[model samples]
Target: MQDTYLHHNHQEKHLKSSELLTDIVIGMSDGLTVPFALAAGLSGAVSNTSLIVVAGIAEIAAGSIAMGLGGYLAGKTEQDHYNSELKIEYDEIETKTEVEKEEVRIFFREWGFSKELQDKAVEEICKDKDRWVEFMMKHELGLDKPDPKRASKSAFNIGLSYVMGGLIPLSPYFFVANSEDALKVSVGVTLICLFVFGYFKSKMTGVNPVIGGLKVMMIGAAAAAAAFAIAKVIDGK
Candidate 1:
Protein backbone atom coordinates (compact mmCIF):
# COMPACT_ATOMS: atom_id res chain seq x y z
CA MET A 1 0.00 0.00 0.00
CA GLN A 2 2.76 2.44 0.88
CA ASP A 3 4.80 1.58 -2.23
CA THR A 4 1.77 1.84 -4.49
CA TYR A 5 0.94 5.24 -2.99
CA LEU A 6 4.46 6.45 -3.66
CA HIS A 7 4.34 5.15 -7.27
CA HIS A 8 1.01 6.89 -7.84
CA ASN A 9 2.35 10.14 -6.45
CA HIS A 10 5.40 9.93 -8.73
CA GLN A 11 3.30 9.10 -11.78
CA GLU A 12 1.02 12.02 -11.11
CA LYS A 13 3.98 14.34 -10.89
CA HIS A 14 5.26 13.02 -14.20
CA LEU A 15 1.93 13.17 -15.97
CA LYS A 16 2.79 13.01 -19.64
CA SER A 17 2.14 16.07 -21.82
CA SER A 18 1.56 13.72 -24.73
CA GLU A 19 -2.18 13.51 -24.07
CA LEU A 20 -2.77 17.24 -24.39
CA LEU A 21 -0.85 17.43 -27.67
CA THR A 22 -2.78 14.49 -29.04
CA ASP A 23 -6.05 16.22 -28.21
CA ILE A 24 -4.89 19.41 -29.95
CA VAL A 25 -3.96 17.50 -33.10
CA ILE A 26 -7.32 15.81 -33.09
CA GLY A 27 -9.05 19.17 -32.79
CA MET A 28 -6.89 20.79 -35.47
CA SER A 29 -7.34 17.97 -37.95
CA ASP A 30 -11.08 17.98 -37.46
CA GLY A 31 -11.15 21.73 -37.99
CA LEU A 32 -9.10 21.65 -41.21
CA THR A 33 -10.91 19.03 -43.26
CA VAL A 34 -14.65 19.26 -43.94
CA PRO A 35 -15.56 22.90 -44.27
CA PHE A 36 -12.77 23.61 -46.72
CA ALA A 37 -13.95 20.81 -48.96
CA LEU A 38 -17.55 21.94 -48.79
CA ALA A 39 -16.72 25.57 -49.47
CA ALA A 40 -14.53 24.67 -52.44
CA GLY A 41 -17.27 22.58 -53.98
CA LEU A 42 -19.93 25.25 -53.51
CA SER A 43 -17.69 28.01 -54.81
CA GLY A 44 -17.06 26.09 -58.01
CA ALA A 45 -20.72 25.27 -58.56
CA VAL A 46 -22.16 28.71 -57.88
CA SER A 47 -19.37 31.13 -59.05
CA ASN A 48 -21.61 34.01 -57.99
CA THR A 49 -19.53 35.91 -55.47
CA SER A 50 -22.53 36.95 -53.40
CA LEU A 51 -23.88 33.40 -53.15
CA ILE A 52 -20.47 32.01 -52.28
CA VAL A 53 -20.06 34.50 -49.44
CA VAL A 54 -23.50 33.81 -48.08
CA ALA A 55 -23.13 30.05 -48.19
CA GLY A 56 -19.63 30.14 -46.74
CA ILE A 57 -20.71 32.32 -43.82
CA ALA A 58 -23.67 30.09 -43.11
CA GLU A 59 -21.53 26.96 -43.14
CA ILE A 60 -19.05 28.46 -40.71
CA ALA A 61 -21.78 29.52 -38.25
CA ALA A 62 -23.63 26.23 -38.41
CA GLY A 63 -20.49 24.12 -38.19
CA SER A 64 -19.13 26.07 -35.19
CA ILE A 65 -22.35 25.78 -33.18
CA ALA A 66 -22.80 22.15 -34.05
CA MET A 67 -19.21 21.34 -33.11
CA GLY A 68 -19.33 23.18 -29.75
CA LEU A 69 -22.60 21.55 -28.70
CA GLY A 70 -21.43 18.16 -29.85
CA GLY A 71 -18.23 18.52 -27.85
CA TYR A 72 -20.12 19.47 -24.68
CA LEU A 73 -22.57 16.62 -25.11
CA ALA A 74 -19.82 14.09 -25.82
CA GLY A 75 -17.85 15.11 -22.73
CA LYS A 76 -20.98 14.73 -20.62
CA THR A 77 -21.63 11.35 -22.19
CA GLU A 78 -18.11 10.19 -21.41
CA GLN A 79 -18.56 11.06 -17.75
CA ASP A 80 -21.80 9.10 -17.75
CA HIS A 81 -20.14 6.12 -19.40
CA TYR A 82 -17.33 6.15 -16.83
CA ASN A 83 -19.82 6.24 -13.96
CA SER A 84 -21.59 3.19 -15.37
CA GLU A 85 -18.33 1.34 -15.84
CA LEU A 86 -17.23 2.14 -12.29
CA LYS A 87 -20.25 0.29 -10.88
CA ILE A 88 -19.40 -2.79 -12.93
CA GLU A 89 -15.76 -2.48 -11.97
CA TYR A 90 -16.65 -2.23 -8.27
CA ASP A 91 -18.91 -5.27 -8.51
CA GLU A 92 -16.22 -7.34 -10.20
CA ILE A 93 -13.59 -6.48 -7.62
CA GLU A 94 -15.94 -7.08 -4.71
CA THR A 95 -17.41 -10.37 -5.90
CA LYS A 96 -14.40 -11.95 -7.57
CA THR A 97 -11.42 -11.08 -5.43
CA GLU A 98 -9.31 -14.22 -5.92
CA VAL A 99 -10.07 -14.41 -9.63
CA GLU A 100 -9.31 -10.75 -10.05
CA LYS A 101 -6.08 -11.17 -8.12
CA GLU A 102 -4.97 -14.04 -10.40
CA GLU A 103 -6.01 -11.96 -13.43
CA VAL A 104 -3.82 -9.13 -12.27
CA ARG A 105 -1.03 -11.63 -11.57
CA ILE A 106 -1.04 -12.71 -15.20
CA PHE A 107 -1.06 -9.07 -16.30
CA PHE A 108 2.00 -8.22 -14.17
CA ARG A 109 3.70 -11.39 -15.40
CA GLU A 110 3.45 -10.06 -18.93
CA TRP A 111 5.12 -6.88 -17.80
CA GLY A 112 8.29 -8.88 -16.96
CA PHE A 113 7.87 -10.06 -13.41
CA SER A 114 8.90 -13.55 -12.23
CA LYS A 115 5.95 -15.79 -11.30
CA GLU A 116 6.55 -15.42 -7.53
CA LEU A 117 7.05 -11.67 -7.80
CA GLN A 118 4.00 -11.27 -9.99
CA ASP A 119 1.87 -13.00 -7.37
CA LYS A 120 3.30 -10.72 -4.72
CA ALA A 121 2.68 -7.65 -6.93
CA VAL A 122 -0.88 -8.68 -7.58
CA GLU A 123 -1.42 -9.23 -3.88
CA GLU A 124 -0.12 -5.78 -3.11
CA ILE A 125 -2.23 -4.15 -5.83
CA CYS A 126 -5.49 -5.96 -5.03
CA LYS A 127 -5.25 -5.40 -1.28
CA ASP A 128 -6.74 -1.96 -1.70
CA LYS A 129 -9.92 -0.88 -3.47
CA ASP A 130 -8.33 2.19 -5.07
CA ARG A 131 -5.38 0.27 -6.52
CA TRP A 132 -7.62 -2.53 -7.71
CA VAL A 133 -9.96 -0.11 -9.50
CA GLU A 134 -7.08 1.93 -10.93
CA PHE A 135 -5.44 -1.15 -12.41
CA MET A 136 -8.69 -2.41 -13.90
CA MET A 137 -9.58 0.99 -15.26
CA LYS A 138 -6.18 1.42 -16.85
CA HIS A 139 -5.49 -2.05 -18.21
CA GLU A 140 -8.73 -3.98 -18.48
CA LEU A 141 -11.35 -1.36 -19.31
CA GLY A 142 -9.13 1.51 -20.55
CA LEU A 143 -11.13 4.21 -18.79
CA ASP A 144 -10.24 7.57 -17.27
CA LYS A 145 -11.98 10.45 -15.59
CA PRO A 146 -13.49 12.92 -18.04
CA ASP A 147 -12.84 16.65 -17.70
CA PRO A 148 -15.94 18.45 -18.91
CA LYS A 149 -14.35 21.89 -19.09
CA ARG A 150 -11.38 20.64 -21.08
CA ALA A 151 -13.68 18.77 -23.42
CA SER A 152 -15.84 21.81 -24.03
CA LYS A 153 -12.81 24.01 -24.63
CA SER A 154 -11.36 21.45 -27.02
CA ALA A 155 -14.61 21.41 -28.95
CA PHE A 156 -14.79 25.17 -29.14
CA ASN A 157 -11.22 25.29 -30.44
CA ILE A 158 -12.08 22.70 -33.07
CA GLY A 159 -15.16 24.60 -34.19
CA LEU A 160 -13.30 27.90 -34.28
CA SER A 161 -10.47 26.36 -36.27
CA TYR A 162 -12.94 24.85 -38.75
CA VAL A 163 -14.66 28.19 -39.28
CA MET A 164 -11.29 29.85 -39.77
CA GLY A 165 -10.25 27.12 -42.17
CA GLY A 166 -13.49 27.42 -44.13
CA LEU A 167 -13.31 31.19 -44.28
CA ILE A 168 -9.66 31.22 -45.47
CA PRO A 169 -10.53 29.56 -48.74
CA LEU A 170 -13.72 31.58 -49.33
CA SER A 171 -12.71 35.06 -48.12
CA PRO A 172 -10.46 35.72 -51.09
CA TYR A 173 -13.26 35.13 -53.57
CA PHE A 174 -15.59 37.55 -51.83
CA PHE A 175 -13.05 40.33 -51.37
CA VAL A 176 -11.33 39.78 -54.70
CA ALA A 177 -14.65 39.44 -56.58
CA ASN A 178 -13.15 36.85 -58.93
CA SER A 179 -14.25 33.29 -58.28
CA GLU A 180 -11.27 31.58 -59.92
CA ASP A 181 -8.61 33.69 -58.21
CA ALA A 182 -10.47 33.42 -54.93
CA LEU A 183 -10.51 29.64 -55.25
CA LYS A 184 -6.78 29.68 -55.83
CA VAL A 185 -6.14 31.82 -52.79
CA SER A 186 -8.53 29.88 -50.58
CA VAL A 187 -6.92 26.60 -51.55
CA GLY A 188 -3.46 28.02 -51.02
CA VAL A 189 -4.32 29.19 -47.53
CA THR A 190 -5.96 25.91 -46.64
CA LEU A 191 -3.01 23.82 -47.79
CA ILE A 192 -0.54 25.89 -45.78
CA CYS A 193 -2.68 25.68 -42.67
CA LEU A 194 -3.09 21.93 -43.12
CA PHE A 195 0.64 21.47 -43.49
CA VAL A 196 1.32 23.47 -40.34
CA PHE A 197 -1.35 21.53 -38.47
CA GLY A 198 0.11 18.24 -39.65
CA TYR A 199 3.58 19.18 -38.49
CA PHE A 200 2.27 20.05 -35.03
CA LYS A 201 0.22 16.86 -34.87
CA SER A 202 3.21 14.79 -35.86
CA LYS A 203 5.30 16.43 -33.16
CA MET A 204 2.63 15.67 -30.58
CA THR A 205 2.28 12.03 -31.68
CA GLY A 206 6.04 11.48 -32.03
CA VAL A 207 5.90 11.17 -35.80
CA ASN A 208 7.95 13.11 -38.39
CA PRO A 209 6.66 16.70 -38.47
CA VAL A 210 7.49 17.24 -42.14
CA ILE A 211 5.73 14.09 -43.24
CA GLY A 212 2.74 14.88 -41.05
CA GLY A 213 2.46 18.39 -42.46
CA LEU A 214 2.76 17.10 -46.00
CA LYS A 215 0.08 14.53 -45.35
CA VAL A 216 -2.29 17.20 -44.06
CA MET A 217 -1.57 19.47 -47.01
CA MET A 218 -2.12 16.68 -49.49
CA ILE A 219 -5.47 15.71 -47.98
CA GLY A 220 -6.75 19.27 -47.92
CA ALA A 221 -5.55 19.93 -51.44
CA ALA A 222 -6.97 16.68 -52.70
CA ALA A 223 -10.37 17.26 -51.13
CA ALA A 224 -10.62 20.82 -52.42
CA ALA A 225 -9.38 19.76 -55.83
CA ALA A 226 -11.84 16.90 -56.05
CA ALA A 227 -14.70 19.18 -55.00
CA PHE A 228 -13.85 21.74 -57.63
CA ALA A 229 -13.49 19.07 -60.27
CA ILE A 230 -16.80 17.53 -59.33
CA ALA A 231 -18.52 20.91 -59.41
CA LYS A 232 -17.03 21.54 -62.83
CA VAL A 233 -18.45 18.26 -64.10
CA ILE A 234 -21.85 19.01 -62.61
CA ASP A 235 -21.93 22.46 -64.18
CA GLY A 236 -20.85 21.07 -67.56
CA LYS A 237 -23.72 18.61 -67.45
Candidate 2:
Protein backbone atom coordinates (compact mmCIF):
# COMPACT_ATOMS: atom_id res chain seq x y z
CA MET A 1 0.00 0.00 0.00
CA GLN A 2 2.80 2.38 0.96
CA ASP A 3 4.74 1.50 -2.17
CA THR A 4 1.71 2.20 -4.37
CA TYR A 5 1.18 5.58 -2.69
CA LEU A 6 4.83 6.53 -3.25
CA HIS A 7 4.63 5.50 -6.88
CA HIS A 8 1.56 7.66 -7.45
CA ASN A 9 3.31 10.62 -5.82
CA HIS A 10 6.28 10.13 -8.14
CA GLN A 11 4.01 10.13 -11.17
CA GLU A 12 2.44 13.40 -10.09
CA LYS A 13 5.86 15.04 -9.68
CA HIS A 14 6.92 13.83 -13.11
CA LEU A 15 3.78 15.30 -14.68
CA LYS A 16 4.42 18.68 -13.01
CA SER A 17 8.00 18.69 -14.26
CA SER A 18 6.81 17.91 -17.77
CA GLU A 19 4.45 20.91 -17.65
CA LEU A 20 7.37 23.18 -16.74
CA LEU A 21 9.42 21.72 -19.58
CA THR A 22 6.58 22.47 -21.99
CA ASP A 23 6.57 26.15 -20.98
CA ILE A 24 10.33 26.41 -21.60
CA VAL A 25 10.00 24.78 -25.02
CA ILE A 26 7.24 27.21 -26.02
CA GLY A 27 9.19 30.29 -24.97
CA MET A 28 12.61 29.11 -26.17
CA SER A 29 11.40 28.01 -29.61
CA ASP A 30 9.86 31.38 -30.45
CA GLY A 31 12.68 33.31 -28.80
CA LEU A 32 15.34 31.66 -30.96
CA THR A 33 13.37 31.75 -34.19
CA VAL A 34 12.09 35.33 -34.15
CA PRO A 35 15.33 37.11 -33.18
CA PHE A 36 17.37 35.00 -35.60
CA ALA A 37 15.00 35.77 -38.47
CA LEU A 38 14.93 39.46 -37.65
CA ALA A 39 18.73 39.63 -37.56
CA ALA A 40 18.99 37.76 -40.84
CA GLY A 41 16.52 40.09 -42.52
CA LEU A 42 18.31 43.20 -41.25
CA SER A 43 21.64 41.82 -42.39
CA GLY A 44 20.34 41.56 -45.94
CA ALA A 45 19.18 45.20 -45.93
CA VAL A 46 21.88 46.91 -43.80
CA SER A 47 25.63 46.61 -43.28
CA ASN A 48 25.80 47.73 -39.66
CA THR A 49 25.89 45.18 -36.83
CA SER A 50 24.90 47.72 -34.17
CA LEU A 51 21.48 48.32 -35.73
CA ILE A 52 20.76 44.56 -35.88
CA VAL A 53 21.77 44.11 -32.25
CA VAL A 54 19.54 46.96 -31.13
CA ALA A 55 16.58 45.68 -33.12
CA GLY A 56 17.13 42.16 -31.86
CA ILE A 57 17.21 43.30 -28.25
CA ALA A 58 14.03 45.31 -28.70
CA GLU A 59 12.23 42.37 -30.28
CA ILE A 60 13.35 40.05 -27.48
CA ALA A 61 12.02 42.42 -24.84
CA ALA A 62 8.65 42.80 -26.52
CA GLY A 63 8.33 39.14 -27.40
CA SER A 64 9.09 37.93 -23.89
CA ILE A 65 6.44 40.18 -22.35
CA ALA A 66 3.82 39.09 -24.86
CA MET A 67 4.62 35.42 -24.42
CA GLY A 68 4.63 35.66 -20.64
CA LEU A 69 1.27 37.41 -20.59
CA GLY A 70 -0.14 34.74 -22.87
CA GLY A 71 1.08 32.01 -20.56
CA TYR A 72 -0.43 33.75 -17.59
CA LEU A 73 -3.79 34.14 -19.27
CA ALA A 74 -3.87 30.50 -20.32
CA GLY A 75 -3.07 29.35 -16.79
CA LYS A 76 -5.73 31.58 -15.31
CA THR A 77 -8.29 30.26 -17.77
CA GLU A 78 -7.61 26.69 -16.74
CA GLN A 79 -7.98 27.56 -13.07
CA ASP A 80 -11.16 29.51 -13.66
CA HIS A 81 -12.74 26.68 -15.63
CA TYR A 82 -11.88 24.20 -12.90
CA ASN A 83 -13.35 26.41 -10.22
CA SER A 84 -16.54 26.89 -12.19
CA GLU A 85 -16.97 23.17 -12.61
CA LEU A 86 -16.22 22.56 -8.95
CA LYS A 87 -18.95 24.97 -7.89
CA ILE A 88 -21.45 23.26 -10.17
CA GLU A 89 -20.49 19.90 -8.76
CA TYR A 90 -21.04 21.13 -5.23
CA ASP A 91 -24.42 22.61 -6.09
CA GLU A 92 -25.56 19.46 -7.85
CA ILE A 93 -24.53 17.27 -4.92
CA GLU A 94 -26.79 19.34 -2.69
CA THR A 95 -29.79 19.92 -4.98
CA LYS A 96 -29.79 16.54 -6.70
CA THR A 97 -28.46 14.27 -4.01
CA GLU A 98 -30.05 11.06 -5.27
CA VAL A 99 -28.90 11.67 -8.83
CA GLU A 100 -25.35 12.29 -7.71
CA LYS A 101 -25.44 9.16 -5.54
CA GLU A 102 -26.60 7.12 -8.51
CA GLU A 103 -23.72 8.49 -10.59
CA VAL A 104 -21.26 7.35 -7.94
CA ARG A 105 -22.86 3.91 -7.85
CA ILE A 106 -22.62 3.62 -11.61
CA PHE A 107 -18.89 4.32 -11.44
CA PHE A 108 -18.32 1.57 -8.86
CA ARG A 109 -20.51 -0.81 -10.79
CA GLU A 110 -18.48 -0.19 -13.95
CA TRP A 111 -15.38 -0.96 -11.96
CA GLY A 112 -16.69 -4.52 -11.48
CA PHE A 113 -17.85 -4.04 -7.91
CA SER A 114 -20.52 -6.48 -6.73
CA LYS A 115 -23.93 -4.99 -5.87
CA GLU A 116 -23.17 -5.03 -2.13
CA LEU A 117 -19.65 -3.78 -2.76
CA GLN A 118 -20.97 -0.94 -4.90
CA ASP A 119 -23.33 0.15 -2.12
CA LYS A 120 -20.48 0.07 0.41
CA ALA A 121 -18.16 2.05 -1.87
CA VAL A 122 -20.74 4.66 -2.69
CA GLU A 123 -21.63 5.09 0.97
CA GLU A 124 -18.00 5.45 1.93
CA ILE A 125 -17.36 7.98 -0.84
CA CYS A 126 -20.41 10.17 -0.31
CA LYS A 127 -20.21 10.24 3.49
CA ASP A 128 -18.36 13.56 3.52
CA LYS A 129 -19.50 16.48 1.35
CA ASP A 130 -15.98 17.65 0.61
CA ARG A 131 -14.72 14.19 -0.28
CA TRP A 132 -17.79 13.52 -2.35
CA VAL A 133 -17.30 16.77 -4.28
CA GLU A 134 -13.63 15.92 -4.78
CA PHE A 135 -14.52 12.42 -6.00
CA MET A 136 -16.98 13.83 -8.50
CA MET A 137 -14.50 16.44 -9.65
CA LYS A 138 -11.81 13.84 -10.29
CA HIS A 139 -13.83 10.88 -11.54
CA GLU A 140 -16.65 12.61 -13.35
CA LEU A 141 -15.15 15.87 -14.55
CA GLY A 142 -11.54 14.72 -14.94
CA LEU A 143 -10.06 17.87 -13.49
CA ASP A 144 -7.43 18.06 -10.82
CA LYS A 145 -7.34 21.34 -8.96
CA PRO A 146 -4.68 23.50 -10.55
CA ASP A 147 -2.00 25.03 -8.38
CA PRO A 148 -2.98 28.57 -7.42
CA LYS A 149 0.52 29.75 -8.23
CA ARG A 150 0.53 28.22 -11.70
CA ALA A 151 -0.24 31.49 -13.52
CA SER A 152 2.62 33.48 -12.02
CA LYS A 153 5.00 30.55 -12.26
CA SER A 154 4.24 29.97 -15.92
CA ALA A 155 4.69 33.66 -16.67
CA PHE A 156 8.10 33.76 -15.03
CA ASN A 157 9.28 30.51 -16.58
CA ILE A 158 8.28 31.38 -20.14
CA GLY A 159 9.63 34.94 -19.94
CA LEU A 160 12.98 33.82 -18.57
CA SER A 161 13.30 31.08 -21.19
CA TYR A 162 12.51 33.55 -23.97
CA VAL A 163 15.21 35.96 -22.84
CA MET A 164 17.76 33.16 -22.64
CA GLY A 165 16.95 31.78 -26.09
CA GLY A 166 16.78 35.20 -27.79
CA LEU A 167 20.20 36.18 -26.49
CA ILE A 168 21.92 33.27 -28.25
CA PRO A 169 21.29 34.48 -31.82
CA LEU A 170 21.82 38.13 -30.92
CA SER A 171 25.09 37.54 -29.09
CA PRO A 172 27.06 37.24 -32.32
CA TYR A 173 25.93 40.69 -33.48
CA PHE A 174 27.34 42.17 -30.29
CA PHE A 175 30.85 40.83 -30.94
CA VAL A 176 31.10 40.86 -34.75
CA ALA A 177 31.68 44.12 -36.66
CA ASN A 178 29.78 43.47 -39.90
CA SER A 179 26.12 42.54 -40.13
CA GLU A 180 26.63 39.88 -42.84
CA ASP A 181 29.46 38.21 -40.94
CA ALA A 182 27.52 38.31 -37.70
CA LEU A 183 24.52 36.76 -39.43
CA LYS A 184 26.68 33.88 -40.60
CA VAL A 185 27.74 33.13 -37.06
CA SER A 186 24.24 33.63 -35.72
CA VAL A 187 22.88 31.21 -38.31
CA GLY A 188 25.35 28.56 -37.26
CA VAL A 189 24.75 29.09 -33.58
CA THR A 190 20.94 29.43 -33.67
CA LEU A 191 20.34 26.46 -35.96
CA ILE A 192 22.48 24.26 -33.73
CA CYS A 193 20.59 25.46 -30.70
CA LEU A 194 17.25 24.86 -32.41
CA PHE A 195 18.18 21.29 -33.32
CA VAL A 196 19.44 20.53 -29.82
CA PHE A 197 16.37 22.10 -28.28
CA GLY A 198 14.02 20.15 -30.53
CA TYR A 199 15.90 16.91 -29.93
CA PHE A 200 15.49 17.12 -26.17
CA LYS A 201 11.92 18.34 -26.49
CA SER A 202 10.98 15.38 -28.67
CA LYS A 203 12.78 12.94 -26.42
CA MET A 204 10.78 14.19 -23.46
CA THR A 205 7.46 14.06 -25.37
CA GLY A 206 8.22 10.58 -26.77
CA VAL A 207 8.75 11.53 -30.39
CA ASN A 208 11.58 10.73 -32.85
CA PRO A 209 14.39 13.01 -31.65
CA VAL A 210 16.44 13.12 -34.87
CA ILE A 211 13.45 13.94 -37.05
CA GLY A 212 12.16 16.52 -34.62
CA GLY A 213 15.57 18.15 -34.45
CA LEU A 214 15.78 18.41 -38.23
CA LYS A 215 12.27 19.74 -38.46
CA VAL A 216 12.89 22.52 -35.94
CA MET A 217 16.23 23.40 -37.55
CA MET A 218 14.65 23.55 -41.00
CA ILE A 219 11.80 25.75 -39.76
CA GLY A 220 14.18 28.30 -38.21
CA ALA A 221 16.37 28.28 -41.30
CA ALA A 222 13.42 28.72 -43.65
CA ALA A 223 12.01 31.64 -41.65
CA ALA A 224 15.37 33.39 -41.64
CA ALA A 225 15.87 32.73 -45.34
CA ALA A 226 12.45 34.05 -46.25
CA ALA A 227 12.89 37.16 -44.13
CA PHE A 228 16.31 37.84 -45.63
CA ALA A 229 15.01 37.40 -49.15
CA ILE A 230 12.13 39.77 -48.56
CA ALA A 231 14.39 42.41 -47.05
CA LYS A 232 16.87 42.19 -49.92
CA VAL A 233 14.11 42.54 -52.50
CA ILE A 234 12.58 45.54 -50.74
CA ASP A 235 15.98 47.17 -50.26
CA GLY A 236 16.74 46.77 -53.98
CA LYS A 237 13.65 48.89 -54.70
lDDT of 1 by residue, 1-237 (tens): 999998778843332564345444554565567667777887777767777788777877887777767766776788789878888888988898778887888888889999889978887887889878878887988887666576677677666665665666666766867676677787878788888878876775568999989988998888878988899899983
- TM-score quality measure for candidate 1: 0.77
- Per-prediction TM-score to the true structure, in the order listed: 0.77, 0.91
C-alpha local distance difference test of each model: 0.75, 0.93
List per-candidate RMSD values in Å. Answer: 6.2, 3.9
* Top-TM-score structure, candidate number: 2
Candidate 1 ranges beyond 4 A from true positions: 1-20, 112-120, 148-150
The CA-based lDDT of model 1 is what? 0.75
Model 2 bad stretches (over 4 Å) = 1-17
Query: Could you give candidate 2's per-residue lDDT for residues 27-54 as a string of tens digits?
Result: 9999999999999999999999999988
